[model samples]
Target: MLAALRVGPRRRRRLRAAIGGISDKVLTDCLHRLLASGLIERHAHAGAPPRVDYALTGSGQSLIDGPMTALGRWAVEHGDELLEAQESSSAKGL
Candidate 1:
């Protein structure tokens, strides 16, 4: 989700499309959490209908460039091994 926002600010619909398959409840929860933590900022537009946009803060960018980058590298290196283990466990019915 943070990766999706790394590009720039996005509306709710755009976010949904960018990070597909997440439930509404989960998405809302995550957004609220990020907002509360000051990792992201939500802006509201003034109009007949309300509109909101979300963008990452400096802290969020740090998180993405630092730990998230490392985590992504780790995943790329070990994802196949993890998948094989999961398959093996399933085969053993465990």
Candidate 2:
């Protein structure tokens, strides 16, 4: 999501490349979800070959700058600990 914002308006193909490891169906679903939530705007230009672009709305930008930033900071602070806990649990088969 942040990557998309950093790049500004992007077509679906660019989004897919920026956000790797996701299936086409998954990316389509996510884009729809974001659109439904009003966090992103979709613009379609009429032409011989249709052009579509996606960009983050003001609300989405605020979310990325606020809660998301805090979440990222928290992850940076405790990610190692969380990974260790997950590894221990997996080793114990629980």
Candidate 3:
């Protein structure tokens, strides 16, 4: 979610599209959590239909730049090994 917000602010629909397979409830829950944590800001635009946009806060950006980047790198480096382990475990279970 933070990674997706890295680009810029996005509306709910855009976010849902970017993060495929996430249910509306899950996305709303996540957005509320992020809002509560001060990691993201919600903007309300006054219009006939109204508009809302979610953008990363400074803390959120820092998180993405630091820990998230490292985590992504770690996943890239160990993904194959992790997949193999999962497959092996599943084979054993069967």
Candidate 4:
């Protein structure tokens, strides 16, 4: 879905390629869940080639806005600790 947005909305097949091709079945299930929760909309208009686009709804964007801000603040505050953990975890594998 993130990659799909990067394309500014696109068909399922294009989104699949962008994100490394999860199976169509999984994609279908995910879309259904998102639509049910009102996070995204399945867009269709009078056109040829049967195009469908998915875009995040207003509420969905609002939901992410809050968490994204919090995540940014947390990363700023804990970045050093996170990096140290990553370095130690890598060293232990040697």
Candidate 5:
């Protein structure tokens, strides 16, 4: 979710599209959690039809720029090895 919001603010619909296969309930729950954690901000617009946008907060951006970046690099470096291990374990019925 954080990664999806990294680009900029997004509406609920856009978020749903960005994150494929996430149910509405799960998305709502995650948005609520992020809001509570101060990692994201929700903006409600006033008009004929209501609109809300979610954007990453400063702290959230920091998290992505720091720890998340490292984690992504680690995944790229070891993804093949991890997949091989998983396949081996599944074959062994472990």
Candidate 6:
């Protein structure tokens, strides 16, 4: 969820896809955790459209900015291996 928000704030659909099949239930739980920790804010706006959005709070942004750099570097190094493992597991029907 933190990773989802770290990328950017968007509607639930966008976040769901960005997080790569994070079940709505799990995403909601993660969102609640972040919100409770004061790391994120969920909002609803006025007007008939009822615009809804999510964004990282100041603390959340600060937290994500630093760790994401490190995580990204790690991902760059090990990402292909992880993806291959996932594919293998999926192919084995795990």
Model 5: per-residue Cα lDDT over 1-94, one tens digit each: 9999999999999999999999999999999999999999999999979899999999999999999999999999999999999999999999
Which has the higher TM-score value, candidate number 5 or candidate number 6? 5
Model number with the top lDDT: 5
lDDT of 1 by residue, 1-94 (tens): 8899999999998998999999889999999999999899999998979899999999999999999999999999999999999999999999
**Could you tell me the C-alpha RMSD of candidate 6 in Å?**
4.9
Sort the candidates on lDDT, descending order: 5, 3, 1, 2, 6, 4
Candidate 5: where are CA atoms >4 Å away? Answer: none
lDDT (0 to 1) per candidate: 0.95, 0.88, 0.96, 0.76, 0.97, 0.84
Task: Give Cα distance to truth, residue 89, candidate 2, Å.
Answer: 2.7
lDDT of each residue in 3-67, candidate 3, tens digit only: 88999999999999998999999999999999999999999999989999999999999999999
RMSD of candidates 1 onward, in order: 1.8, 1.7, 1.6, 3.5, 1.0, 4.9
Q: Worst 10-residue stretch by lDDT in candidate 6? A: 1-10
The TM-score between candidate 6 and the true structure equals 0.68
Model 2 ranges with Cα > 4 A deviation: none
Can you write out model 4's per-residue Cα lDDT over 1-94, one digit (the tens) per residue? Answer: 6435543666778777776758889888988998899978889866676678887787667656677658878999999999999999999994
Q: Which pairs of residues collide in candidate 2?
A: none
- How many steric clashes between backbone atoms does each model show? 0, 0, 0, 0, 0, 0
Better of 2 and 6 by lDDT: 2
How much does candidate 1 score in TM-score?
0.83
Q: Per-residue error at 68 for model 2, in Å?
A: 1.1
What is candidate 6's local distance difference test score?
A: 0.84
